[model samples]
Target: MTASLQGQMMDMPLTVSALLAHAARFYGTVEIVSRRIEGDWHRYTYRECERRAKRLAQALIALGVEPGERVATFAWNGYRHLETYYGTAGFGAVCHTINPRLFPEQIAFIINHAQDRYVLFDITFAPLVDRLAPQCPQVRGWIALTDDAHRPDMRTPVSSYETLLAPHDGAFDWPRIDERSASYLCYTSGTTGHPKGALYTHRSTVLHAYGAALPNALGLSARDVVMPVVPMFHVNAWGIPHAGPLAGAKLVLPGKDLDGRSLYELMEAERVTFSAGVPTVWLGLLAYMKEAGARFSSLERMVIGGSACPPAMLRAFEDDYGVEVIHAWGMTEMSPLGSLVKLTGEERRRPPAEQRKLREKQGRAGFGVEMKIVGDGGRELPWDGVTFGDLHVRGPCVIDRYYRTDTSPLIDGWFPTGDVATLDADGCLHITDRSKDVIKSGGEWISSIDLENIAVAHPAVAEAACIALAHPRWNERPLLVVVKRPDAQVTREELLAFYADKVVKWWIPDDVVFVDELPHTATGKLQKLTLREQWRDHVPPSARGDADCPLTDVSTDLNADHAGCVPPSDRATRSPP
Candidate 1:
């Protein structure tokens, strides 16, 4: 094959509309399986999925959900979720994925904000639906994604999802919408503030789906039994839902439960080879693997992201089970994929210990993505490993603006990711910390991650979390919270001094508290926002810029001196929100 032919647009497809058509026409028998509502296996094929999706398109049009109108889905990963994806977009209506994890108030606000006309939610969220129904006025239609056999008593005027399509002829010509037509919308994780919607175009979604299935991306195929543990309401389920069918992979849906036992059962029964989820999910899987002495006979990979995976967890997967952990990093803005950590052939041949270090760092940027590190002055930094700066990215899938936000902070054509990172000489991305999570003292930024990592190195710590608190003198200072191991005892001075050989003395946290446990989000990363809120009310006399003034709101006192203060028992070596 010539180079010209390889990159040529000729003889190639233009959009996801083509992908679905091809999957239905040529790869019709490919299975798209889901867990049954009656607690058994449900089996179907791509041809049926496509036919139903088209019928759904016809139904949307019949109901007068106009082109460019939004239809929301509050669902788990299942065949119906897959149907809505193609069905909504096929009709030129945007599929707005409303995360069930969001607060009920936030859910109502988003439904109102997005002006979603219909909601197709899984039976699992029935109670939350009942509670929020009275407030969500824009949702004129409510449909439960369940069969008559599994239907629960619902307070709303609901229809069975299957029944919604039962009478339709199961055929509709997809609209010839522009590739740039909006396809799907996913709101950001709302912990920091109100959720802002990110609208993805058909062009962007199709390109991302293609890129994600490449040899290095997820290496998917019709042969690989794929199950994405990531939630569909978040970042297109890490873009797996579309990628799987596009690659002709036998997609498996782990509806509702993601606990270790359920995952193992699904993987073993389905012979699932490729899987993806955040680190916390893997930790649960790892615990189950050990406790049950379970091992997969056909599994190959475990893609981890949303937060950094610890070296220990990474080690356990590769060393014990022969499963590769691909540590990926990105934000909601970057189609949620910027850097994926997988070693090049040359690096893989190195000593196992040496390779571990490289695998732990975020991998090189993917084919279509470009990355840069910029200092606080917004000056682009060198790619040399030593220079650390904010991570900015640009790509076909990366969003230029949040659809719901009035003022977008994305700068100069690049999305300003709040992460502090470095592009090493080898092109690997090393995440140091979040820009706000780093402590700046005497005009120098100290990585809370580096401090926390060094603290966890001491065997006495079960988990260590680091945060910056207000200092009277230094603009910001470090705080370390540690949950000690049952038989181990560690103190503030001892832990601070432990970093003596590793990091600069001034960089260590001033206080170390032993907390009984740490707070975490539903997604499993340490809840720094909750921690910041709790201590946001605290101020010491020395660090108080206002001098003995009480801190009613630490967020308002951003300019306060953080010269002296430290963290209490934290959950990990790195807890960047």
Candidate 2:
């Protein structure tokens, strides 16, 4: 028997630099629009961006930055910041996008941990650098992403961004660094201990970008004008920085001003066709549009992630503005593009009500991402769509370990996403709640996300958060904290009654508390941990469901020790919360 010979093919490496080079070569004339901090649109071409990127790369080399050395950037989404991304990673240096929203101490710690040699930031963050520079002694120089006239006077000697690049003609050839070399570093927003870094390689980034460009994912193309309202500091703005160029999509970068009016103006002016951001930003846009009685003339799709997209927001975008809403789910560890909610042909043919139900889910896993649910016994759960389990993901882009940490977070080669979810037989993923945020009542698990989503759907409620509060008998019960719409009056009884018709009696919150606004993290996720701490001593108003409650139709015998029963306090800590 003769062995079959493998087909000879070009061994082109999948690297970010290659992605940019391909764009510059094929789509050089494609427009790249950016809203500058000066409240003006800064326009350029992919060719110009690529040339400037090379110039910036040369500038990095001139600054004594070596290959594999970390260069940190604390800037908003704009042309200069985008250039920094390409320049740093395209030239084989690690681009660590530090989240300026983090505490000063955290910024210092991350910069020091990454051993960043140069810190480049926007003019807005000059004050921040001035305050944190004293602590980050490892950073040799500070490069401001501004002109000489706009540069802030700081204690540390600062370099002008344009001046640094003036010497380079962008004629230098890009080196072929190993595809496995470190390219990007992003730190998880640590809820427990200190933030842990996730180091990504060029291969993983390129692969993730490819995944993001797939039609089932971001649906990027050369004709699309893409805008990412998500901060560049967060998961490379959900990998749009690379995916845009890979697909040759015209890119639009919204700078520091991310409010509804500002975003709408930029989107209208740039004629952006696709955009991605958290649900909160979209909510703001919705509010602004409603007030002005305007519609998105060009936007075709909006991707909502960072947190679950409210059903109302999804409906508002589609029903009111004729824009399709794509709900996405991901974390910093998975090159941040895990699953996007896109309907199949068969699903799309269904009735609007049925389709909306499917849209509420986080959607099916992307091509490269594999997802499974695991039980407490370390066994894989069935994809029945009803049984919830710990969501575990394995993919080419998923993180195997934290940067600089010896501990491996993988369990049997699968990275636990810390999310409790269910996967249907059709492979659609429904994220019920985060593992830590799941509220345990008696022996049953009540999904906080489900409750919050339901509560926010109320017209009077602007936002809502469900946190587990200490209970004497049930051990822990859900407390619904709501922020009412302006001038809206909603009684506690009214809200509880509203839930009675939707969820089971056991799943409803014991009481409702109104606040001016619920707290949110830097990335716009509901900070349930802080809420849990703030309402630690909360007292439930009652346990028994109301007589008119919809749950009265179901079995309610508490003595049966059912999963929904409010058991005594002894079994409170029996299992992980």
Candidate 3:
């Protein structure tokens, strides 16, 4: 074969610093509004952000931070956190973002594991820092993301963020570095074991920003005012810190106060045109709006991910309020921008019902991403939309291996997503359930996500989780656990009967249990593992020889004890029937 001729083009490496530079030069006047931890709104321009970021870089350098060293940040979504993102990575240091919501042990484990040189945190985490200071001995300094007046007194000595930057005159120039060098480090939620880190390169991060800002992906532009309700510590806030600035869109960072009222008021005040967050955040906003009989004044679209967006919530946004809802799905390893659900020209021409059905899926892969489903024995599955299998993906922005791990988790070049999913003929991705979370009953597969979505569609149901219970005949059967809306009553008989027409008879849950609340991970995903442990020994009515009990009697039994006929206290020492 003849050698192909290379095109003549500039070979400047893509870096995160370049993105901030472009924003400062072109979108200088664009506003970046943030809610401060001191209960006030802070606003600044991209030019000013660039100056402060440069000062931060100078401060880090003067403090003896070297290239590729880890600089950890424990902060909320705010201007200081944003400055840290640009300054640390811009100066060729790896910006390690630690989730504050993690357990104290996990937090310490992360800090020590990263061998973080310096720790920067918000004032809200002062007490946590004091508690963890003794555990993370390698940390050279702790800087509070606040001024001297707002700084809290802690057991450990801490420096002020603003005070540190005060010495630098913002004259430092960013050093050009290889784009393949590590720029950011984020750990998984560590639901199973110690959270492993995903180290991202500057090249991959810049590419991810381009893909995320694509018209078919997030569709970001300078005309849009964007707000990321997702914390900056989580997968780079799904890469909005990079993508939003790349698009030159005005940004609004809602710190700490993620409740419905605060979000609504902020959105209105800033005229936020676009936003992205997990479904739980939207649930609160929707509930608050319903109570206040409010409507959006400028908000136009929302991107929902982190977990499946319930059909009910989607309809409530689009039908009740005229806002478009985009369903998204991804993993930390993929830079968290894999698939987004947006209608195509042909899809838009379809019936409303058909469009809604298609929108319920996770949607198609963004540019640079390739996905497929595989079955047992490592065989690739077809995109027939009906055959669910293990989902795997590979792309330019995807992680090849986890940080500090010896073995590669990739199988034949694709990263197994640990999710059971399907791809339709048009290449749309449909997530059924996490591979570990899928239910197996009598050798048949059942999707707990489907059950939970349908349950939440009920007006009286606030949130739902379907967990597998030990069964004598089937080995495992599903039990629906629900939390009711305030002042809303739902009987087990009514809820069970409501599922009759919506799903296959066998797919329906065997029993219903109401609880005051369900557990969630730090990122707001359902804690199914915790739920399973809580209900591991639960006996469905069928297994208890009480399948024929009257519906009213079963309702009374469930109401009397949230654990069904047998309360959890009684089942502690008992075995499955």
In order, candidate lDDTs are 0.79, 0.87, 0.90
**Per-residue lDDT over 397-490 for candidate 3, one digit per residue giving the tens place of the 0 to 100 score:** 8999998989999999999999989888999999999888887665466789999999999999999999898877666678999999999999
Residue 336 C-alpha lDDT in model 2: 96
- The C-alpha TM-scores of every prediction are 0.87, 0.95, 0.95
Task: State the lDDT of candidate 2 residue by residue for 57-155, as single tens digits.
Answer: 999998889999999999999999999998999989999998898878778888998899999999888889999888988889999997887788888
lDDT string for model 1 (1-577, tens) is 5566456555442456667887788779988889855577788998999998998888878888998899999888888988998899887899999888877889998898899999998988889889888998878888888877777798877888877787798857876778888989888877777788889998888888888888877778888889998988878888898888888888889888889999999999889999999876876788689889988898999798988777777777988999998889877777777888777788889998889888888888877899988864677777777677788889888987888667776789888888888888878899988876777664457787777667655767757788877775566667788888677777766776677676644665656778888887645577887877776645533354432223223435433322332322221112222
* Model 3 CA lDDT for position 358: 90
* Worst-scoring 10-residue span by lDDT in model 1: 568-577
Q: Is candidate 1 or candidate 2 better by lDDT?
A: 2
Q: Candidate 2: misplaced stretches above 4 Å?
A: 1-7, 543-556, 559-577
Query: Model 3's lDDT to the true fold?
Result: 0.90
Q: Residue 348's C-alpha lDDT in candidate 2? A: 90
Q: Pick the candidate with the highest lDDT.
A: 3
